[model samples]
Target: MNNIEFIRNEEKKYHDFCYENYKLFEEGSWLYKPVKTVMDLLPLFDNNESLNVIDLGCGVGRNSIPIAEAIKNKNGKVVCVDLLDSALNKLKEYSKQYKVEKVIRTEKADIGNYKIKPNEFDFIIAVSALEHVKSEEVFEEVVRQMPEGTKNNGVNCLIINSEVQEIDLETNEKLDVLMELNLSIEVMMNKLSSIYTGWEVLKTVVNPLEYNITRSEKPVLLKTNAITYVVRKSIG
Candidate 1:
């Protein structure tokens, strides 16, 4: 199929899967908890009286919920954006359940097409989200906008999956990976390094991961290199 068709199919798959998974923060699941790295960085903005944060493609407030709790007392707001309505609906429920409803605002939009205002946010996070953009060009443009939208001394934390491969466990046959912008490890690193030039690289890590997952009722072995790159925008 063509790129657009593939992307549409992928979106539907995710939408259905998200709707089926009613619980967030469930034990032993991929969404078991928020990323520790994201939580660790929240203390850096403790002194700010009012904080503005953006979470691109935030799935059911996995990271957004904790961030809202951290900044609730300081008039902090976490703008949670996702393409799926079900995810956002669940996030709203969780926000109310956690008593931080006032701190979160939800927006439904494709991350690639979402516009971020310049120098507006103290923290911008896109976890396991960038790789789903429509293409590598869109990925670069979004990355370009991320730092531009971040205020000086602000942070941008991105967790992207690269070099994804899937194999049918039952037949040991290779299957087409559904990612929209599945760049090679080398290309992905180069793009980040070039775009984030002069920024303070607080953390840079690449973890090779292989896991078993069920997709379309078939067991599959998914292999990917998960890259975490966190940087602070430098002030002139």
Candidate 2:
């Protein structure tokens, strides 16, 4: 299958299945929890009342719910964007359940095509989302826009998967990696550096992880280098 087809299929299979069967933060599920790193960096903006944040590929408000809860008193807003109707629907339901509906907004759009408004956000996060973009160029463009979309003293947190290697468990042989834009570690780092120059780099980490899963009805082991980058836009 081609790139777009592969992406759609993967999205339908993984995202649809996961969001359908598993409750957010359900025990033993991949969606068991939100990224702690994202949670950790939130306090940096604590002093900013009226917070505005963007969560690209926010699935079912795992992180967005907590974010809304944190900033609700401050009149904070978290714009949760995803391509799936089901995801957005669940997010809305959960926001009301958590009593943070007033602080949450949902947008249905593919993150690749979703434009970030200039200086419109206090914080922007895309966790394991940008890799699914159509191409490396698209990825770079999105990364370039991240800082531009942030207000001064605001932050951008990105957790991207790079250098994916899928292995067939039974045969012990490598299989075709299915992500749309499987960028190399070097390339990913270089682009972030070039685009986010002069920003206060808070964190840069590369964690290698392995997961066993059934894909296309076959048991496979997926390996990836998860890159986490957090930076702040210095006030001029």
Candidate 3:
């Protein structure tokens, strides 16, 4: 299936609530807090080097526009990568309207198979967009392709579904599947770090969380919002 199909399938079946709650996540709402939390990590941007940031699986520019606004004054720029044309088109228009167009460059492509420079980015963000990636191998591949040391001293932010948890159902008292929507960060450092020791190249990893309790208390099992780690990434 194509990216849109992939996304729609996930949203409709697993995360329809997040999609339906998009308006609140759009600008200034409680749901938008997570996006804001993601941008707050930008303080790590030293701005000494040419700022090259990447927004992986950027959906409609929620986090992209905010990052662009924050770094527009500096010699910084953002590259938003996504698999959906609909999201890219909307990001284009929003960047223009927000007056950060000059600082934002968007690309329509799949992260699972895209050819990106190794360690080229000063920052890489994957906000609320990992569950859709599905396979651990694919997820690792995306990281493997990252410009290795190019992100030296850089930060990579990620939001994904944490390990599944069990919830007791009121009806039958049987345990049900529940997961925490997680917010995590990975940093790229020079020397080795504890939080990062996966593929020789990753520097460090970071995690900061802000979650929304699913509004519905229906019989359906619901997941929680959780922020998992804080680490670094470096290339081999």
| Cα-based TM-score, every candidate | 0.95, 0.96, 0.65
Best first by lDDT, ranked: 1, 2, 3
RMSD in angstroms, all models? 1.4, 1.3, 6.3
For candidate 3, what is the total of clashing residue pairs? 32
Candidate 1 wrongly placed segments (more than 4 Å): none
Error of 1 at 49 (Å): 1.4
What would the per-residue lDDT of candidate 2 be over residues 161-227, giving only the tens digit for each residue? 9999999999999988888888889999999999999999999999999987667778889899999
Off by over 4 Å in 3: 1-36, 47-49, 147-150, 164-195, 198-221, 225-227, 233-236
Which prediction has more favorable TM-score, 1 or 3?
A: 1
Task: Give the 10-residue window scoring lowest on summed lDDT in candidate 2.
Answer: 6-15
* lDDT: worst 10-residue window of model 1: 14-23
| TM-score-best of 2 and 3 | 2
lDDT (Cα) of model 2: 0.89
What are the per-residue Cα lDDT tens digits for candidate 1 across 1-236? 98777766765675558546646787755677899999999988988988999999998888999899989999889999998877898899999999999999999999999999999999999998999888889999999999999998999999999999999999999998877888888899999999999999999999999977767878889899999999999897
1-236: candidate 3 lDDT, tens digit per residue: 85546545544443444434454245643335346556667776654546778888776677878888888878788889887665677678778888999999988776676667875777777765554554555655565555352466666665554443334445534343332122222222221233245633322333433333332344433343433333445443
